[model samples]
Target: MAACAPDPEPRERGSRSPSASGRTARPGEGLLAQWDADLLEAAGAGDAASVTALLDRGARIEARNEDGRGPLMLAALADRVEAATVLVERGADPDATDDLGDTPWVTCGVTGSVAMMRVIWEAGPDLTVPNRRGGSPLHPASERGHADYVREVLATTGIESVIDRVNYNGWTALLEAVALGDGGEPHQEITAMLLDVGADASLRDRNGRTALDHARARGYGVIEDLLA
Candidate 1:
């Protein structure tokens, strides 16, 4: 089996102004970065036309905000599929990561937007890339109860190596679905999908507890039955 990948922090992206570049403000480069900042705003706001115009005017497609979030990452975070499409068409990197190690593709998993997932997937994101917390895209999707995102990506990407993969904390996507999730409909759906796709039921977390154990501990009777 392929080695598992990791995850990033699950915190929301910081509220940044148009610019989020962590780079030192070079005195002479301030003005030049403004257009890039504009592009960031446009992408985040789903202004596809503005995004195109900025890029045409030589806005850095890779320009980042104060949070290290580039235009494409912002677009993904906001589920601005149109902006993301324009950015992708203009050579923006979907794999661009932010302060939290979240790329546009990884952020798609966070947003649970299957549409955004398709956009980033076509751009060929590195499925193996983990977030800051050492969790793969699947980890966030599973934990956050992105049932459709998990199901579609699993079907479309057809990459099963990530199914039973563990994170830095030794939690697999299955473990996360049970441990972090609230066992709501979405969470239950995600759990069922993971199991159906052959996620390793025998996998244990760093605490050496199975997913079934976690479900039972949390009174997730529905999940426990699934695990059983």
Candidate 2:
């Protein structure tokens, strides 16, 4: 559930608009801009050395791209574990959200990278933060049938409260799992994990359909039994 915002208009390298002082550039502004750009590039490329170099050169670790995604977010989105580690170790905020309110931790759920998840988690992200859809990372992980990611999220402290949190569409993690799942082993395992952690089977969606109804309608007998 990444945020969807129009990208900011592109700017030239080291370019700056005229300020109130009629100055097109300030002291060290060009250097900082270039460092930020390099940091983004290094992060996206998973070049830990370049990332560290940029950080050491006073690049703002939280500097965002046009989409409001910072270095850690880009690294997580790209599954660049090494770059993510470098950013986190250099004091990047793992909980930094993009324009869509999607944090690096939440992005890890989408990538289904346990290593990224662990790296971001160890950096102390706020697991309670919801994405733009008003769902926690567990929501996307569950919807995508990412059993391992779902388990890791549930294992996080205070994440149990997020399991039953409904999204903008009124589908909780369990409901999404049941609705979007293929009734495969992964889905079944996810369902079991949610249930074992006390996810309410009786929760309904915006259409007033419960997880059991979805399972039954989809003819997911195994899931139906679990919901029952």
Predicted structure with the largest lDDT when compared to the true one: 2
What are the per-model numbers of colliding residue pairs?
16, 1
Q: Over the stretch 1-228, how does candidate 1's per-residue lDDT look in tens digits?
A: 997787854632332223357743332355557778899999999999999998876689999889999998989989999999998888888778888777888787788899988887878888787776677788888999888889899899865667877778888889999999998888899899889889988988888899999999999999999999
lDDT agreement with native, every candidate: 0.85, 0.86
Most TM-score-accurate candidate: 2
Name the runs in model 1 displaced over 4 angstroms: 1-31
Query: Candidate 1: worst 10 consecutive residues by lDDT?
Result: 11-20
lDDT of 2 by residue, 12-86 (tens): 655446667998754268778788988998999999999998787678999989999999999999999999998
| Candidate 2: C-alpha lDDT | 0.86
